[model samples]
Target: MNLQGIAAVVTGGGSGLGAATARELARRGAKVAVLDINAAAAQSVAEAIGGIACVCDITSPESVEAALARASAAHGAARVLMNVAGIGGAKRVVQRDGSAAPLEQFRRIVEVNLVGSYNVLRLAAAAMAKLDPLDDGERGVIVNTASAAAFDGQVGQAAYSASKGGVAAMTLPLARDLAQHGIRVLTIAPGLFLTPLLHELPEEVQRSLGESIPFPKRLGKPEEFAALAAHIAENAALNGEVIRIDGALRLPPR
Candidate 1:
């Protein structure tokens, strides 16, 4: 899909990977809609890129649907949808308190990371299906964010890992289901990215995390993820696959 003049929606565009992807898409000539629960952050990024910002809470279907409608009104139905909103919650299945982690906590993670992604994809794909196909009969592309933890989850990451794992597992079937409509779906399993979660850590701890990487010994940049996303958006053949951007680092159990 040629990104030039295409309409795109990026969820969680308030900051981090989502923000980077929105900027990159804008740079590529796509009209972007920056959607996030943080209205101020979303508006800031959207204004910077001359795009629209729609306040959206991915976990709420009404919020997501409303945001989609707003985005469509501004940029037309999106041909590219990027699902980058997620939360990282940490807890042992059984805490030091000698109690199992509350089931609500686990369910919340799944609600946002897995179900939220699906919600946006469903809405976006439905809109894309109504559009005329571009090159190679491609109508749209959907990119989802997962994490390397899905494969190498450490201690205190059961909920986070399971949520991301669900995202990874759903890629193929989603691609297949949308294939007839000329829409492609792909997933990215990022490793040790320098997102807000990592950035908030103590400097020494951040360094330790970076050093954990086998090579290049640094946190993955959000722009690097954006680059890959842009490539996937343009490449029709890259579908139903989860590409890891973790510098050859397979995390060990903590």
Candidate 2:
């Protein structure tokens, strides 16, 4: 489980939490592969961390295969996979006009967040399974990104929440499924963080959102999320768990 010189794959590593994780992993001596839908961002981060850059579409099987191949070619088979490539959509099940929400909206969220994550995890785990076991019989570790909304979704968050909830719900079972291969799976359900999307909001809006947290009264930093993920990578006893990094902020029902 030591990250030293191990191959690691980080999807959505262009920016936000994934980018932070990639940097931290590199800092911890892991040779990282930065995969993202944004080729430029991926290249930038990879260049910054001296890692490999892979342009990948997590939703496509062919894309995932090619990306992993490139990653492996550059940095051997990955022993760590961070599934952070996801998208969010906000929509209620019904509208005020007595019309149901478009099913496509719901499907897209689940496809990117849930299905995409599973796709990368499976592929990376397979590669990890083939690696010679490290000390303590550990082959690899997977850290999946969920959201606090999965536990306490507000109004208009049905799609996003459902997608994240599926991630949270699958952690233990997936870990069990992969345990025989010496692979560990865990989920990190983060609270509001200063991701690029949220950082684009007005300063006052950002402050108000940060003030909602119970303590620290500010948005969680991307580096903080990375720190927890880095710790999980090294700690073998932490498996099949969903740890929330929300500053004790249980969202309101809105």
- Among all windows of 10 consecutive residues in model 2, the one with the lowest summed lDDT is 85-94
- Reference-based TM-score of each model: 0.98, 0.98
Look at candidate 1 and give me any clashing residue pairs.
none
Go through the candidates in order and give the clash count of each: 0, 0
Query: What tens-digit string does per-residue lDDT give for candidate 1 at 69-115?
Result: 99999988899999999998888889898988899999999999999
Question: Where does model 1 exceed 4 Å of error?
Answer: none
* TM-score, cand. 2: 0.98
lDDT on C-alpha atoms for all candidate structures: 0.94, 0.95
lDDT of 2 by residue, 24-66 (tens): 9999999999999999999999999999999999999899999
TM-score of 1: 0.98
Segments of candidate 2 deviating more than 4 angstroms: none
